[model samples]
Target: MDYIANYVDAIVIGGGHAGCEAALSLARLGKKTVIFCLNIEAIAKMPCNPNIGGTSKGHLVKEIDALGGEMGKNIDKTYIQSKMLNTSKGPAVHSLRAQADKVEYHKAMLKVLDAETNLTIKQQEVSDILIENARVMGVRTITGAIYYAKAVVVCTGTYLKSKIFIGEFAENAGPDGLKSSQVLSNSLLDNGITLRRFKTGTPARVDKRTIDFTAMEAQLGDSKVVPFSFSNSAASIKKNQIQCFLTYTNEQTHQIIRDNLDRSPLYGGKIEGVGPRYCPSIEDKVVRFADKSRHQIFIEPEGVETNEMYVQGMSSSLPEEVQIQMLRSVRGLENVEVIRGGYAIEYDCINPTSLLHSLENKVISGLFFAGQINGSSGYEEAAAQGLVAGINAALKIDAKEPLIIDRAEGYIGVLIDDLVIKGTNEPYRMLTSRAEYRLLLRQDNADIRLMTKGHDIGLVPDDIYAKFLDKQEVIEAEIERIKKVFVGTTATVQSILMAKGSTPLTSGMSLHELLKRPELDYKDFAAVNLDGPELSDEIIEQIEITLKYEGYIKRQLIQVDQFKKLEKKLIPENLKYEDIKSLRIEARQKLLEIKPKSIGAASRISGVSPADISVMLVYMEQLKRTERANDASVS
Candidate 1:
């Protein structure tokens, strides 16, 4: 017997990183939202890596914050250690990564969700998404309670009929021994949602007391912490950081894994899902890179409260005995006791091509999908999708235009565009290389790029938006001031330049030009002028980057303009690609299947070539001419 329980404007399934962000976004936008999870304690749980943000992923987190998402803010509150990566490279690649206290992070997010007046958190597994006439009605719980909603966002992170495997042993469970949603797969399949089996694994957690830290190199966090959130500052969130250790795997470790290849489920053909190519398991890495003698591994603390340490680069699904043998072969982990052995978990995820750029299903009007359910890996990627999906779902209810961030806008846009167009065969991970205009889509300037959009969508608060606007104004003013502030070829200027290891000025130069020098930086200006605007580190960074990369930025902007033109060449929804006689059979098939919204999107499809794009442009022009002729004849 099914019972009517409650009603809400929207329902978000799965309380993982994606679910938290989606529910919060929907609720904050004045929509009454209810989030369902198998267990309340699992809300925003870091089931795999006990860290957030890395390389390109940091850009996503900053963009998420810029767009009024909770991840960056929550991470700022609960991170145990913080470090900026790729500092030796250009500013474009500089990314902020933080080690999170997994337990505390979860609690902090739950607190935020609890405080949201329009949001409800329920510890119940959603068994079915009730649909009527190709639109979402609500979801039915496992206990046969029907909760109605105008929209539903599925964020089921690795819990849809998930099964964990270790050697030949397997169990029906989610990450960290959580209950898997077994019946929901059928519901999704019945609703015509195509599902794919994808696999991802996590490394073992070793008992901290049993590990030998002396044999490992101590990895320290940055002395001056960098916060992930744009709303936060270095001074505001300073604290004593925790220590992580670095170790490596030797020939012995490799030998053990190679010898036990037959016992490994992945190699033995016991696991059917395709694993991530980038983040492979230990055995897979050793097998794939046979020439490599050693692999780097980081031993990181899970949290301050727990005595378990996460083995960073050593994800495996070998048997317990083999895992023990593998661990003992490593240097510092020679005698380390395993608190939890690593295993790979396979789950059902949808082919992201079925989703629109807004993350809404094309077949089902009010159905949205985000996170791992969209075949994307990593917490940051999941959160980015969640925020967009949540905002779009709310906009749909409000009868407003759906927010669509194009490739030229932010990394979030690039992430979605790739997933929607290319459609990954394996779990998709965000990479800086994936973004074409990475110079414009930097982590530091995420707020400048997308905060306005976030504010216009009713997600960013007025106070925060005001702060962002003020920062923008100050940065612009400072850049203008610097460009006009002339420095003469005085002895004082030469000495200062010489001391800073920069080429002595041959003639008068502006502060902006001085900053462009390879050896000179904005900080060196303190010696030149004491009267310079008292600016925060953030503002100074923006000014320096803007001046240093002015030429490159301008070039990218021009490229972006070209990209946007193709993006603006909208494809008519009803246009039959089969009618375009010039298109190749594969191109026509792909175009018909994808039904891309723009020429730019269609061009990105794997099978669609440049020649096909030219054909499309011609056909569109022909169609326009025919329409114009028809109008003229009627007149």
Candidate 2:
């Protein structure tokens, strides 16, 4: 019954967050693309957390929006509650997080997918990826239909041969009981794609009516809302935000988990996949931090239509009876009724070191990988990878150079470079601490940092690009204007400074220099200096940050210059690493396997040492000298 189905310019193998971005980007670039999933209803599903953007994750979301991706816009349209986290900290760590209406988020994204002129959404399980002469040909579905394509992107996020575990019970399924991709792992093995197992867990959902809100602390959303997408302002996306409650796990709850340790699948050796270290289950937390007296738990609504309340910090894999016992032990959940128990899922993912900087496979010419399949753990991480992979796939078909974002450019670059160069033994999560130039890579300036690149790739529209350019010019002009506006020790200026508790100005100082003071901000400067151009809050914020951190920003830019020198020194694809006698055996093995494109990338490899880089530089110079001598003799 096997037959040819259809042919397209590109094929995407999943429909989750990563797959959605991948499909949309390819189609928008004028490529005929088809995205396949086991169930179309699961497209852009948020299986684990109820919200998007937290800490470093918020930066990833804004970066996606800046790159003309859909995640930021979709979240803005559907969020029930939005908050800006870390206001007390520096702007570099300030991130916007929002609790989304899960059902509506999915519907919004699906509508966009359906509306795309060149994109097709198919409900099918991609069982095999057809390869011819080390290049992708197409994919075959479980129903024996072969759909041909010029390029393929494998974004099978946590579904390839997925299995769920709760206590001693196990079932072959994906998140929320969706169908597991059964045979794709075998097809991947057949083609020499290395696969590994990674496990992630979700907490139980209890009925909201059964919980007592009076016993918990009321956690309120921000009074002022912030939009995730650069195109939308706060005024456009404002709504009545919902409220969430916070509770805590006491020693009694910890004791309940400790008593059930023997019955837990995670500790009983029933689950084999490595889980994320950063977002560990309650069981892992209790066992690891035994001395701690309590842990915080947030109760959040799943959606406006659903009564299910997600227990944020209580993810577990114990028996249902133990789960109930632990839930009831918390303050507000004393009489809570569990709608569904939490479970851990183990699924197949690839060794990310197999991918190039563009998310393309080194050995497979037209094959790309992204999201959890690349060993990353968050929705934002997956969507970021998908956007990059989709853009690279289209560029490859158009016979253009690939878009490679390096560590100096943005957080996306740091995420990819960490995964492909160093490789991860556990699921990789993005953190602000991971980026060396985080001060310069703040979430507030993501559009400034990346919109031009997105426009160059043809994803950003001309209208949006023009707006960004105007905003950039306004910010630069204001900064220069502020540098010339001086405030002397007039009675009015001294009174304003005294009211703000700042050091009294003995002599006249430029507004830019005054902004460098820890106490004085742009608003404080405006209060002192009367005549200034009216600028939007967004532009003013950018100018404030630039003047406030000029010295630090300049220092980081110098570091970036030094880093780019090594990056610009390209490595020959066919260089014999073993020929460098000074290199360690382990270094040679790693370099030979990775075939890194630049000395900067090679230096970041885990096994490659500084001494090995010196040897490489010397050997490449010798090769150049020999080539020049031969040319001279021929002349």
Using Cα atoms with residue i matched to residue i, what is each candidate's TM-score against the true structure? 0.99, 0.98
Candidate 1: tens digits of C-alpha lDDT, residues 461-507: 89999999999999988888887888888888888788988888778
- Runs of candidate 1 with Cα error greater than 4 angstroms are none
Question: What's the number of clashes in each of the models?
Answer: 0, 0
Write one digit per residue (lDDT tens) for candidate 2, span 76-193: 9999999999999999899999999999999999999999999999998888999999999999988999999988999999999999998989999999888999899999999999
How accurate locally, in lDDT, is each candidate? 0.93, 0.93
State model 2's lDDT.
0.93
Please give the distance, in angstroms, between residue 302's alpha carbon in candidate 2 and its true position after superposition: 1.0
Report per-prediction Cα RMSD to one decimal.
0.9, 1.1
Give the runs in model 2 whose Cα sits over 4 Å from its true position: none
Task: Report clash pairs, candidate 1.
Answer: none
